[model samples]
Target: MNDTPGWASPGSAPSDGQQPGTPGASAPDDRPDDAPRPAAPTEQPGTDPQGPGSKWSKEQPPPAQWSAPTGPQDPAQTPPPPPPGPGWGNQPPGGPSGGQGGWGTPGGPGGGYGGTGGPGGGYGGAWGTGWGGPPPAAKPGVIPLRPLGVGEILDGAVSTMRTYWRTVLGISLTVAVLTEIIVILVQGLFLNDYADTSALEDPSATFSELASAMGSALLGSGVVFVISLVGTVIATALLTTVTSRAVLGRPVTTGEAWRDARPQVLKLFGLIILLMLIAVGVTLVGILPGLLIALAGGSTAGAALAVLGGLSAAIVALWLMIRFSLASPALMLEKQGIRKALARSAKLVRGSWWRVFGIQLLAAIIANIVAAIVVIPFTFLAAALSGDGVGSFLDGTGDFGWTFLIISGIGSVIGSMITLPITAGVTVLLYIDQRIRREALDLELSRAAGVQHPAPGTTPGS
Candidate 1:
């Protein structure tokens, strides 16, 4: 009798008298007799009758005989047809297949190789889709209309100048020239009177004389500070508009920027004044206790109180400054009042204090570096050109003539022209970035730019 393993098809069974598990049977005898046997071959559960594991199943049909065609067969052999359904026979080496390779076919909806869905996709596989896709491409502007990195913020500032050099440079140069001229005139007319060395060299100089000199110096400095503050506010207001238009890839003239910014100039100035007053008040309050103590004749205790109070006041002032740094841009762009702008700034900065602070600090450092690069050489030239040379310049013992002032003013103008736009642009862009992250202002920006369709997840007025 045919005696191949019972699992073999009838026609393929051996023509011998051995059954499966016998010494001469093709089936291996690894299992002990007592071991539980798999389901019977005729009704094996979960096993595909035609699969590789079931090659010897009795249900399999006999193989078809191969016959040469009447004409010459093609030299290349025809590949075997794939199995009917999903299984190893149809699967590629890479993975499950509908085509070449596996599920990770290149250039498919699933990104190249194992990537899930191109750049739009977050990562790979089901997990990537579940997590959602990446943010949409930012529209062109001074910035990319997204959460900005520090480098991008800095670049945006520089780009504002490069993109709109004439308007930006004109505004800055006018302000710088006017400011320098005013400063030089004030010094030459009033402040320079007290800069004489005779008063310093006089052995009989009284305390009142010294007090008068200090008071004069303070007054001059205060006047200069006020002028500088006014110029800064104007620059900031105008530049805020420039930056806004630049962000939308729109050109803005100095006239247009000035006109738009003019309405908000007073509000911005008020905001600056309010902030300054708050800072000054806080510092004064902190130092008041120490001043009282000192006046009461407790020198050591007064000194200690002064130190503690100053430190406490400084901390509070720094915190508030950071919290409200965006107020200028908010006021200028939104045309909000002092209190509203302050509130808006506080809201935007609520959870991003450190980030804002770090960026502002870095911008300040960069501005200073740029200023130094321009100013340092001019300082040396001024000193060398002065009749008294370096000694008189360093010691402040010689008169600073028109030549020194003019040369230094040139440097000041150059430095201001570059630094003003950068500082103002960074501030505006920072405000916009914060809004984009916290409030999705990019939608409004896109709409304003005449974008026909908003990106996914962005709704109108949202």
Candidate 2:
């Protein structure tokens, strides 16, 4: 068996004279290019001149130095210089100059990681590094300063609650308690009369009596609705400031949020009222033709026309509502008047009608689902505790005493406490997301956060 290393064996070692496969070897003019030439081996001290296996002897002299051919030879027959070693000819291992795809080299159509001047250039290449920019500058806030996706929006809302649980939950709980109390009071005072629907089961009941009952119910509901709306507005206003500060990674007290939001409350209120008026006006206009027909005579044709008109109006109202959904946030945050906020919302939502509508609808659905999850069990428990079964409670056939109302109101409060933050947070984030996408609001947010390197030419707060 050969004891020497495979490379140092006679078959592989470079001979003293020009060897067939060594750098001094000549190439055939017609031969196709072959593998790259190997670099000349440097002589190591203490190595035998003949071979690694040979022992040094007094008679043997050191190996002679390698020398280049002095005379000019046929250009076609001369082999190219041996390839340089790693880092020897300004080429890093596995780098571009090494003829292997590596960092800063165009790996393919879209440049690979760190490649430049290609379709996919920069970090992770243009083919998408599976992320948008670098992991957004560490977010100390509820959300990162970037265009948000649905999951991110939801996460941010949750993050706000998690990061500032005391303030967020306190605000939500207070609003929920107040709203629920008002609703319960209204129901107790005004809706008690309609709580018993036994009159409707009586054969002696007249259409006028039924209409009167409905009217009373409507009146009570309207009052409660107004109160709830006011509570929601206040909560949203205060929470918007909290959320805005949260985006900058700042913690806020309930008092701080209240103080910041108070100045804009009236403006927010006016904006809400204006929006309601516009919605009501649109609805009235859309249903006017049908209303006039129905009032003239309650004929089948009139009923059909009324239905058609009301349907048309409802569609328009829905569109308008979605179109101006961001107005409240804009009004509160920007301190703009109702008209300007409405205009701002309209501009942001102009080209993104379906997108905004879909996101809003999804958020509403999620909120409702969450509320139901929290409220349904309480409702059932309330019914059971009140001596009414679930069926009777759901059917509204059982007597609804103060006990039942209070228990149900507790459930409502709990549900509201949980859902209010989520819904309000989602709405605010959606507004910010739209602005980030359209207006590059992330740059402003970054500047506000004192990020070391904000997008160039972007002034803070601009």
Candidate 3:
């Protein structure tokens, strides 16, 4: 009786070990119905056991024609024929019944020869793991097309700067030099000698004199702050374009970057102003109650409450700032308006506020540390070359004349050159990474880069 389905019955050669046409061969009814019968031989490797095959006949190939090789064949050479088994009318290479290199031999496909393995053996017998695991994610450019870790994000920024140093450094250096020149000119012409703070140092100074001095100082600082803010906005817009191109493994010139960034520069400026106003307004609201109390003659208690309120407002402002940190990149890269960009950044940063904050803080710390290393030395040197010498400069009483301003401005320019690219690159890369994690933006990036990415629901193997 055959246990396996679709196997031909061994009619000519009975199950009682008698060959066809022999005297001891019994009729089919002589053997019990439940007795085991060997399966019919298959013609091909890896064929389904239940599928149809060529008809079985009493005739069979000779033992030598179907038997396995006697000795272990050289694995490097061509593989030998598959070993013979019961249905092939041969006892295999061992005992007459069955033994090594026979039907149940280990390391062979389905416990026989002709399997995925070494020379003549099956896969599991000789060597270890057949193939390695799945492939790594695609990296068509500076970053891989997947969600990134912190180190990978930072490395991508640095890699972009290094790979396209000509464009990156050229843009950064030009912007930094122009900004420093304007700042130096403004300080030297309007604030250096005209805005006097000497009244702030006088013990007998009248209230009006102190107020006038303070107002002048604030006006000068406001002018410088506005100039610096404009410079920062321009640099950010340009560098955002550079970094986005670098991620596609494309090189960009200053002209190309300018053309791309020019359209959205105004929107980016508006976004920055709106964010600043929100922060300032929140801070003012926090202290408003205390100011009202102080006007009603509760000065001591009002001061205490104001300090507490200010600290809490600062924390809230910081949270809002981090939450919206991605707006500039969104605005520049997506050509979004101020409100839309702010909403987009808020959406991307919603669940990852702390993570975004940590990365931004880390980048800021690293950029500042590097800038300090480059700037502090120039500051000392500038003091040494100034008119009052290092002592007066260190004491903060020296006149910041052209010599001091020029020397120190050179240092500031150099510092900005290094830090600007880093900060801009990190911001852009963080935006890309967030999109990759949230929206599977890597597929679009891969297509944009001309890399062949698998379709959705498919893998590299498929």
Best lDDT among the predictions, by candidate number: 3
User: Which ranges of candidate 1 are over 4 A from the true structure?
Assistant: 1-136, 189-226, 452-462
| Candidate 2 residue-wise lDDT, 166-257, digit = tens | 99889999999988998888787768865444556667976446545655765677677777767776777779988888889988999999
What's the residue-level lDDT of 25 in candidate 3?
A: 45
Of 1 and 2, the candidate ranking higher by lDDT: 1
Clash totals in order: 0, 1, 1
- The local lDDT score (0 to 100) that residue 337 gets in candidate 3 is 86
Looking at model 1, the pairs that clash are none
Candidate 1, position 49, lDDT: 52
lDDT of 2 at 284: 76
- Sorting all predicted structures by TM-score, with the top scorer first, yields 1, 2, 3
Q: List the residue pairs that clash in candidate 2.
A: 120-126
Model 1: ten consecutive residues of lowest lDDT = 86-95
Instruction: Sum up the clashes in candidate 2.
Output: 1
Superior candidate under lDDT, 2 versus 3: 3
Query: Candidate 3: where is the Cα deviation over 4 Å?
Result: 1-128, 189-230, 295-297, 454-462
